[model samples]
Target: MKNKLTRIICTTLAFGFLALPSAQAAESEFSLDRLVITALRAEMKDLDTPASVTVRTGEELKATGALTVADALQFIEGINMYSQGPYGQSAGRMSSEIVIRGAKKGTLVMVNGAPVNMNGLFQLDNILLENVEKVEVIRGAGSVMYGSEAFGGVINIITKKQVDNSISSSIGSFGRHSHSLNLQAGKLAFSGSLVEGGETGNVTSTSTKYTNYTGSEKISLNGAYRFTDKLVMNYTHSKDDINKEDISLSTNNRQQYSNDQESVDRFSFQYQDDTLLANVYGAFREIDYYTRNNDGSVPLPTMGGYPRKADVHTNLKTAKYGLDTNKQWEVRNNKYLAGITLETEKYEQNKVIMTKASAPASPVITNQQTGPFERNVIALYTQATHQIDDERKIILGVRGQKTEAEQGKEYTQLLPQLQYNEKIGESSSWFVNIGKAFRLPTLTEMYVTSDRFTGNPNLKPQSGWSYETGWKKQIATGAVKATYFVLDMNDYIETDSTAAKMYQNFDQYRNQGLEVSWEDKLSDKFSYTVGGVVSNPQAYYNRNWSRLYSRVQGTLGLHYTLDKVSANLSANYITDRANDAPPAFPVSLTVNYKAQPETTVFATVRNVLNRHDVTTESTPSSMSGYFYGAPRTIEIGVKHSF
Candidate 1:
């Protein structure tokens, strides 16, 4: 499919902005008093932005009993997590996955407005809820403000700088345990956590073959310093290590291997002031894969079939460095924004192998290496807002991206966005957003060829447009919002159906959906949040359509507070997905008691019903059970503030 329809929608939206006079801004999806930063790329109340955005405060985060940002994302309406077993570390290449509307390459995750979706993986694993200030979610295209990867949505986790001093500890099922500390002294503050867990089960096996996950270790640290009232500096670092055992039944004598250690390390420095926000970050992720038995031999991935020929050890690593800055100014009823982004990424791989023969295998090793392949990106963007009248407003945004890479030709594209917000009354409002979205192929998809994947340097990028319209109303005791969105994409990227499955581009894909959410206070000390999504996501191939995943997903949360105790219960529901899979329902509860003015005790329960079924597949439509949800786990911890 071509992108001709996008031009039509863009023209229509531009006409609506001029013809529709009495439009500006009005209600909030959460509360009228709430402020959203990501929706507009600046500090503005939710009532003033023409986007579907959700803001979760620090207090509300604690109520959900979530230790990490990924845990809480699982319950959000249009978001999904395909974790192999738990949140931090899992068993496979695509483990601990996060996607919006089942598009893994579309959503972008950030910390304080800095992109951290390195190597096509979400970067939220290092952020602890305790050190967060707020989380902002913007659905639909955000390429105008961010970059190409923000095609589906954007998740921004804002951390607290000067936090209260505290120390905590907890222990739970499957040798799960953690320790954390947060402290602030004058203008300096620091927070960090160490988590460890062990699990041995059928987390990734599909044919009754034996599989085991030995253990995983994770560490996260954050620090900040305020040099002046309007200037601050921040630093973040995280490390992860995972160990597992693998066995392939199709191989001779059921060949075996051990994941000696699969690890990732990330660090970043951020600088912020009244007029500017910037970050410099780096990441390193590697996997030490080795085969066991049979003269250290393993099956080699081939076009015809898997052949047991190479005795190989694999090492894969990705290194990234990025810097993005934003500058803004105000002139009467208009606000202008100018920004620039620069990033460089490299993919490195090393394979140590020796071919095996019938009699004996060579004792010498043959080493194969791919370049520390580099890709550089340069982008410039701007946004301008004008108040048409007392109750009407319009926004214009655009971005230009230039790419120079190792294999593909030099590529460049421009993305533009238009928005209009209208105020209906003192308590209700409506808005419309029409924009362009895109996604470039990652290095792994174009440069790295391994045992299971074939690279395609000829792959083209994916391009599309997003159309969204929403309305918000504030009731006496609660707020309600409804959003309708559609996505039309061309040259949709996927794996080809050949003996050697190389990455390829498809004809077209379309996704449209409706989302509804309501938050209310039932009583003086009781409240609830409800959200649901109805969507039909399908791909067009060979002039036919096919479903992506479940068509319906919903969430429910109940909160109660009285005296010194508070409790929260949350639930997620999904209809039957593709490939004869079963429906999914996962629920959790958190209870906290303020033992003293500076101390508190809390307990959390996950997977209350313990339904250990297929959580997600390798692909959106695959039936080869690749992952499952986390089992029931209990944790009790105490926190003391000094």
Candidate 2:
């Protein structure tokens, strides 16, 4: 593993056209003066925030023909966008999930400065780029500023506020078509998109087989109005319908898998000025699903009786509302920021089953039930920065929170963070940061006790300490960022596999890693970026820490433009994986040309290398119980602005 990491790093530096670790869009530069808000609730320069950050612009994403955010985020070094095929091809896990430092549920997701993660997970494949303005990612613990579910990091998706009118359409492989529209009138701005498509031949593996067709329909709607220069309101909605029919070779059965419908709605009102920023918002999410075999087949009778057909349905719904506010003050070159947050979430689940076995026995007519749960949280947080000299500064921050759950005992905590940064010169600086992080269990993880799977309401919250140190330098046309981080976690949550076992608090685990990246322009029409990460993120399994992540993961990208034509090539290589790991290497290419002053044409080819990377896995073994990657496919589109 060490030799492979060294060789890759050396080769990347020698090539100069590196896929730098910073996933910034080519149009963006990590300059010291760039403004960011995810690291701290208040606006601050990248150099002043003292953390590893990356930003991707929506314009560049659309121009590059990225189908969704998941397509672009896969190239970032520290994140693993484990997905069951882009769009709606495979239903492996639940949705497109982002895992940082081996923690899947520890990443906090937000939009426009408000928490948007619903029911412990958020869907990324449905968020088209047309409605986004930019994405900001802070790659370390943020629990001191944000209360819970930030044990790994924070990702904030900023939607477009300024209106730009345009209409676009596209058609791709596997009988796919999509359209988008954006318009502005008076004080209102709107953007919406619709997409549908899939292929039967693209997703398959040597052991598992996806013989039939899989497809999906996706929609997004967003609108905003400005009441005044300092006040604004916005509403965003998304819906997705997915279905797939496949042949399960392991079971030797023909079955169908799907999440019939998934949707989200968000409404927010905000007031912002030079000294204060506040938001009041409400959000809701629903996921409905039913799974059964293609034919009406019943389970084999266990008690010497005939079996009968069955119908089963399951659904999950959650409603969340919150208020977040921040006030800033500057005194004698020092800065202070204070804020308060109040939030409540209600989670409900419904299940219905109908079946009858044994012809002479009494048949159950109907079965209906629900799981109801609620949690309320209040938090106060503040940050203070003191300048000891022109080149040195110190930051101290803390958060206090009280949480109450309907099915569990009340909990309270106080978390703190500290950082110190010093400048070496005008273009370089180094910093050290230490903080505490925590993650609260989801409603399903705590209160949903059942026959097949049991949940324990008394499970404790996972808590940890984070230590990070990094250096940043603005070198010539681009920049360089290097960071080393350690995460010490205690009382990790684990679910025992014993029959009808419950969720429980287990032992300890740690994640430690090193990251180095660079992005720059080589000439007037060409550019390259390179970055890599080496880490051994461990998970507490059985009696000890096991399951290390991919030891060496590197990103690759190159962009070229001349006149009205532009092209981009991107890929990722990962090796030294877990348990008989299958090979993983996929590449993508995109080309664009300006046809007219207001019209543009583009083409995108996914899986350019046609690599048979593993997309979905059922076990640790590589020989079976898995699905393959997206076959070589091409898409064409055109956009016109009015």
Candidate 3:
């Protein structure tokens, strides 16, 4: 590993040297507009953000065939997907979740700047990435700006706005395909897309073989109309349905049926002029999950089986209304920003479970449940950027939020954040930030109950403090960024691991890490990027039980463009992880691909060596069930645009 890393460093430096003369000659053509601007609220240059941020553009997404957000995020550094399979499946221990800088998926996900997390269940599918124009990732705590559940990081998905009339389509492996269209005219714009796909294969579990079938379909619409110069209206709607048949975990020979349906609608009004800006928006989302499991003869005493059947269904609905107001003013020789926001969310979940077994036995169990939860949060925040001198600036901000949960139980928290940026020279700058963040227990974690899992109503909120410092250098030919960060969490909430597992609050953890990255346009036809991260995380529970956390990962990538053709190859490696235990089998990999512009001719391969490494581990009891990485599969496809 060391030798490979050394060779990579040398090759990168050599390329930079070879391209220096041309870079200097073309310096006059360089413009800030060519650089991507992330939606980090401050509108700072991507290289100047206090936290590590990565931007993946729509063009890149198309070239990579990234049908989901998880797929798109695979090339980024320090991000990993824990899923049952390549296609998103609810079972098999691999949840459709993303781990960022070693933090779990409960991290905040935002669309445009509004929270989209439903009832603390991050149900966002990568299908949304189809219409995504760009994604902005903040690699550390952002609760000061985004509210609770921003403990690890924030991923903001910015959807495409019509800039021109266009249509595109493609068909690929696993019976997958997609179509999209966009139209723009003056102040009126509209876009729509459809995605349909399916999978059929033989799946094996515990030495038992079963046929699996999975399919999904989605439709979306977005439009914007300008009523006047100061006010505009925008609307969006989306619906998705998925169904599958697969083998069960406990009964490896028995087959089960599962289905999911989700829908979302959003409307917003924006008024802006000069120094004042305001936005008011309303959003609604619903998700439904249904499952049917089969039990064969020879009823087990523990499970109460023999010709048994179980049906489980869950429904969730959320309504959110929020308003944001921001005003900019000058104080002394600096600019100051003041903002106030009010948001209210009403959430409800209904679960029904029924079971019947044995021709002669009556219904053994039946459950009809309703869980209602509501939260009202109001926040006032103020921030100021002071120019202390020609090369130094400081940002000070504070936010206070009052939250009311179910039964009018209220909680309030005061979070303060500070950042400093200093220009060391014409080509270098340094930045540092310190802030606090918190996460409230999810409704599922508080009140939901079933034969498999139980909830705790007395769960307490988790809070943490995070700090990071980094330096960025834009040299004559490339840019380099490196940061070190640490997080100390208290009152962490995790499932209890005793004999009869239940929800508990006797866990605390600490995560610390380093991230280093370099990107260079070695030449007009060739550009490359490389990044690496190392993290050390540990968890402590029951006062004396301590263990290393799972998901310490790393990544490297290279991108080259020649005329109308481009190629990108990325390699990701993750060390073995543990949950309150010791290290297990680590996941390591090298994925590579290339694409041609306008031809739809693409070739790619994953797990080139066919390494059967487990990418994740189960929590609580620390079971070692494994998820198989793709075994050297190759894909070829064509795409067209009009």
Candidate 4:
């Protein structure tokens, strides 16, 4: 089977390139002028960063019918998704526990230059993707600029700034449909979208076979005014709401409803001159979520019966302010860039859960409020980039952070980073980076106490030291890049499941991995990319090492265009994995297609051979199993712009 799969993949790549000539010519057209300045506080080319990164453009997203950020990122290397089921009951509950270079969740996610840390849980759903202009993902620790919860890496969503007026809509199987509109005039831009979908098992063999519905609405507006050629001011606002119905087969055939709403407002000022550039930004955000579960056997209080119900609510509010400045100077034949940044963030979370009884006779009640928690963090950082001669460059960076909790614990950290880039040839470069990063426990991780889990007030911070090296080559045909990285983590925070719920403590672990990718245009009409990643992740406790570590992932893509029609096909695979513990079945072969630049259709036969794949097992004995990848379903949708 392995040999056959390999042969098929190779055949597809060869055929895809043989059909494209224009694509081959466009591959060699490289100019630095197309690059845009990013607020990531770093000066980097698309190919220069010493980490694994992937960028998805707005056009590519529309072509693939990607309704969410996670959907669009599904094809990227080293990324995966988990869900309990399909539709509303399990809708927003899907876990995007992004694992980059073997680092799991706890990664930092940002939107429009602001941190969207909803209690250290990255749940910015794909509904937000409708208003996104681009996405930049960096794999590995990035605490120098982002601070806490960056131990895994960073995902930045850049919202759209409309250049013109446009509207798009689509409808498809399983009661799926959507519509969107964008408008821009002068210095102002506004956009809005609505999506509604439902599923009933009758349509396909893979359908979840339950009544499920999901609806979402979102809006964003931004404006910029130039005070002078070197100065500008900008303001932006965004809001989103999502509602879903839950359908689960395991527990008494109960139905549930979940709703999530978020709003963000931000303002920024920028100034630039021949040798200096500075930016200041301030932002505020609020997020709220509510869920209600109802089992069939439970009767309403007015009906004189017991009510088997659960209600959970959470609210989060955050304020952030920051400033950054950069200066450039030249001496002899060398040039240098020095920059410094200061930022602070205050975050709070309030949660409540309740259970009730049907009136008449039975009387029942449950604790409603889980203790509220708040945390504040402040950080200052600096970085310097020096060009030594023309073939070699060096970067030195460091950050100092102070964190305060409402419970009276104060924590501080000093992290440093060093990197070097050497031009091996006119078209090739080699780069290496060594850095230290840390992550503080989340508010819930520190104070929340519930029937499902327990919080640990004494839990120490988790720290990681990582070393990375890579090579990038841009040839006449296309581009090739490869990287090798290893991380040694101390005081790793993991849950202990021996108790009824779970506890937290310091656990040691190590992650080592390699990634390689190649993209080439065989001809003007054909282009292809092949990439793969392999890693060994393990845990250590009480002076003993556990062997759970080994994962292999890979991808191959092909594209062809003829006049007004364009076609794309790609397949991704992940081998069975283990962490010196039990082995999980492999997940392989997800294929997607886009016909005509505006229409996308996909079919993913997860666990192709119908294998039971266990992707994640939480420390508390709560396990998430993917028993047969989504049952082989077909998704078709069309989009139009005017």
Candidate 5:
């Protein structure tokens, strides 16, 4: 009761921010129509980019009261937050996955222009939304500039480059608590955050009965230094630990437990001048996993029967070093970019599994493996942009990539891109783009081994190509766009369920989609946005529809500001999406209110329609059986910036 009152008081205090005096530079108003897009690897206006792009500013995200980067992206068109957790809990035993335009395994997620999404880990929980400056989502092929894991699209998270000194604390339902601090001094800046939270299961349902307790903790630190006019450096470190306990099968007492922990460290140095740009970076990532399953059928020591306990432990480490350089030149009506990148990565893995034995305390190690491998890659790329006339422009780009592995065959690929943009009117444009991309198999997917799955050393790289055409119109108060895209892929990798869950290349995969969106200011105090994507994805060999690919997905958002108070409401809906047994129609809602200039309160109610449909893949033989869809949940929180 006391805690509830305290929360009310905090919320009340936050709402009081509106009562304070308003200060601004001439009370000038900013419009979303003025956003300029730079995530296409070039400086261009949103309507002139020749691709489908969505930009979410930090201010807009903050208004939604999302705690993590992934949460803030839920409303983006074509993005499927595959698993938002049961209830409002964001952390599960495994990382949350997202599917874009019917492409589940081909998305690339980056932070400050660095790749952080690794094999099988797609969540962005490590990066807090509080530190994010903006998010850019490119909904098409990006391999020409971003290399592997980019066949679907690219999600670029930009962190705050300038942070004012401040400290803040927040508490929410589901026992969520967090504290953060940011400090800046001249050329040096530092920021850090710690979050602790979890969920308690619902008691009324069969699925939620024993599948309740989930807990997680995350810590992150970032620092930057500007040593000189031409030299700058930045470093970031983060750690996450998650725990889950649930019942796999409802008929038995088989309780499942899992613990996953990860740590990442990265450092980058950059040099830039008029026509010369260079960067050197190093990164290290490590993960530890432990899982235990006990059916409780094993008799106690006094009963003289073996305990039915099964456990597995795995440790994986990866390190990467890379150097990149780019030179820009201009000649009359033509501009060119020439770049080269060389990178080397090392990977090591250790795994052990224990099964039931005569001794209850100590089980026999039934499976064990140790693997260490390395990969080297070099890429050369060049791009040219020519202005033919005031109404027409064209871009041509090409990249050659080569990869060599320590214990596998070498691979090479030549990717190319062509784009054209034409001005339709003073405030509208039409564009088209075609590109090729490829992704090499990761070390874990190529060398790791376990009871349920095995890696094939001879796995081949996956290659694909995509084409898109779009039109955009900017009105007096907002913008609208429509796009049509198609993807053709070959040598796509997948698990051959007929062969002990080994990985194999699927012959061909195809996807075609249409995306449309509109955002406008209805009035001086109100704004609205509506967008959606519809796609058809299929595998040629089997002639089957892709799993979990939604045929129709959409989002709606509304914002209103009156006097000192502001309110925001947004919802996302997905239809004809498959995960476990049946197709699900999932919808989520978020509402936020600002009480003060630096304080706000928000509530998120996911699965508002009470659709308990599963949102993840499930397997019976391993710890994956615990994967389930999020349930209807409501979370409320308050934040006060100081």
Candidate 6:
């Protein structure tokens, strides 16, 4: 493993791209002052924030032709993105999910600096980049400033707010078609997109077995009115709909289809000045889903007398509301931010099953239950930053949260953090950060009951501590960075297959990792970026597998530009380090040509190697299940700006 990793890193450096570590520079041609907010919940210089952060500009994302935020995040280091297939392909466990530092459930996802992770599942695949300005990622515990579900890190998708207007359309492989538009006029901004497509061949089995198809549409509107130079009112609303087929869990032999519909509305009134900034806001999220399983063939009495045919239907609905207030003050060389957040969520589910046996032994089950499974959370947090000297600073923060669930379970938690940063030389700086973080069980994990799995109301929240240190160097061309981090976790929540297939507080785990990355512009027309990470994990969960993540992973990219053309070649590698290892090594190439000032043509060939043989075992029971990767595919698109 070490030799292979060394070869990968050496090969990348041989191409004049040295692999360093995490944290991204905010400075881009289209950004303002190179400022980021995910690290501190306030705008701070990219390299100055006392955390390991990474930023991907909207332009960079657009260049990648990624249909979703989850797709775009795969290029960064220290993050393990597992997908059954390319971008929109795959279902169930193969669907896209991110793991940072071997921590999957501890990540916090947000949009416009507000928590948007729904139902405690960290699925960000639905967040398209049509109107996003940038994505900021803070890799490490962030609960001290962002509250719960930040045990591993924070990912904040910042939308475009400046005045701008553009439109584009594209058609690609597998009957894929999409259209998008972004418009901004004075205080009003609107962006929307429509996409429809599915796999041309079978998703998993051969001969087009899994009937795969997916379609999604979304619209967002934001309006901000300046009441005065010191005050403003902002309103934002968004609606998204997704319809697709669920390949179902590999363990399930049933074919299923599902649909998800969601809508969100937010309003905020704010007051800001040189010395003070405050805001009051209210938001709501409504999510609805429907699923049906079709098993057309039934068994006869001669064939073991199993159910000849069966049909299952499920419906789930959730409503979430949030009210929050935040205020910040600046006193001399000291800065302080204080905020309070209140949230309430309610969920309901219904299921029905009908089965037909060989003879007169037919059974039907209908379970209709309305839990209004409720959850209420109140949190208060404050952070202070003090400049110790000309080149040194310290940050201190703390947060307290009270949570109440419908099951009458109540709990309170406190998170604290400390960080120090210093300038070592004219072009180098270093930082050390330590923090405590936690994640409360989601409503689904606590109250939802299903035929295959049961919820445990007694499951406790997972809490942990993280320690991180890093050094960064700003060079004339680009930059280099390296980060080392460790996480000690307790009361981890995982499915227990030992008995009734239930959720439980399994055990504890420790993860230590190192990351190094570098990006450089060698010339006016050539640029390259490379990064790699190594994670060592120890699991004490009484499970056979000690680590569920790859021991070594890396990414490399080379880009070239001409007056009217641009091209990029990238590669990613993941070492099989888990007990039931699933390794991936995919390479891709992309090119864009500006046929005219207002028109551009693009082509992308992903998985150019066509290496889809990667496989892994099933979960929970750890049975003989199999998972694969996306096959090689090509896509061509054209866009026109208006």
| Clashing residue pairs found in predicted model 5 | 15-595, 17-596, 18-595, 18-596, 614-629, 615-629
Candidate with more favorable, higher lDDT: 2 or 5: 2
Q: Which stretches of candidate 4 lie over 4 Å from their true place?
A: 1-42, 46-50, 81-95, 126-133, 200-252, 255-295, 300-367, 500-503, 541-550, 578-642
Clashes, model 6: 8
Ranking by TM-score: 2, 1, 5, 6, 3, 4
Worst 10 residues of 4 by lDDT: 200-209
The CA lDDT at 166 in model 5 is: 71
Per-residue lDDT for 147 in model 1? Answer: 84
Model 1 C-alpha lDDT per residue in residues 1-642, reported as the tens digit of each score: 224643553365345323433321211123544688887877887767798887887667666667888777777777766666565344435546676665547888887777767667755666788788888989888988888678889988888878889999998888888899999999988999999888745566567454566687878888878777666666776766666555555642344545544565655566666677776766666666665444234433431243433356777777777888889888999989999989888888888875544444434558999768889999999999999887789999999999888855677879999999988787778999999988888888887777666888887788889999999887888888899999888887766656566778888877888989998875556667899888877776434576666678899877766566666777888885665567787877777778998888889877766666566743433345555666677889999999
| Model 1: worst 10 consecutive residues (lDDT sum) | 20-29
lDDT of 2 by residue, 368-447 (tens): 55567889999999999999898899999999999999745788889999988888788888989899988888877788
Per-residue lDDT of model 5, residues 1-642, tens digit only: 655754664465346433334322211243544443333465577877878888887777665556677766767777877553542233432466766777657788876666666554554765666677788888888888777778888888777766767777766657767778888888887888987767645311244335655778889888878788777787888887777666654554546666778887877787877788787888777878777765577543222333432277777777877888888899999999988889887778777776655656456676555667888889898889999999899999888999898665698989999999999878999999999977788776687765567788898888889999999898888889999999888886766655477777778777898999998875666677889888876654333435535677788776666555455556676666543334555444455556777776666655555555555532222223334554455666665666
**Compared with the true structure, what per-residue lDDT tens digits does model 4 show for residues 1-642?**
865864675576457546544522221232321232342354466555556666656545433435566545556666644333332112332334555666645467766555655555444443345567777777667887667777666777766544446666655555555566666666565555565545433111112323333555555555556567777676667665666555655553537666777776777777888788787877776777777765666453222354433366767666667776667776765555666666665656566655555443554444345444556666777667677757888877788888877679888999998878888767778888888888787666677666666888888788878788888887787788888988788886666645644446547768788889887766667666688888876666434555432467787655666544455555556664552223433222323344545443443322333333333433213432232223223344444444
Model 3 Cα displacement at 79 (Å)? 2.4
Query: Which residue pairs clash within candidate 1?
Result: 23-391, 23-392, 24-391, 24-392, 24-393, 24-422
Segments of candidate 5 deviating more than 4 angstroms: 1-40, 84-93, 202-210, 228-231, 248-254, 297-310, 355-367, 541-548, 580-613, 617-626, 629-638
| Ten contiguous residues minimizing lDDT sum, candidate 6 | 18-27
Backbone N/Cα/C clashes per model: 6, 9, 4, 24, 6, 8
Judge candidate 2 at residue 476 and give its lDDT: 80
Where in model 3 is the C-alpha error above 4 Å? 1-40, 88-95, 126-130, 185-188, 200-213, 224-236, 248-252, 272-274, 296-310, 357-367, 544-551, 579-639
Q: Against the unseen true structure, what C-alpha lDDT does each candidate score?
A: 0.74, 0.73, 0.63, 0.59, 0.70, 0.68
Model 1, position 292: C-alpha lDDT score: 45
Ranking by lDDT: 1, 2, 5, 6, 3, 4
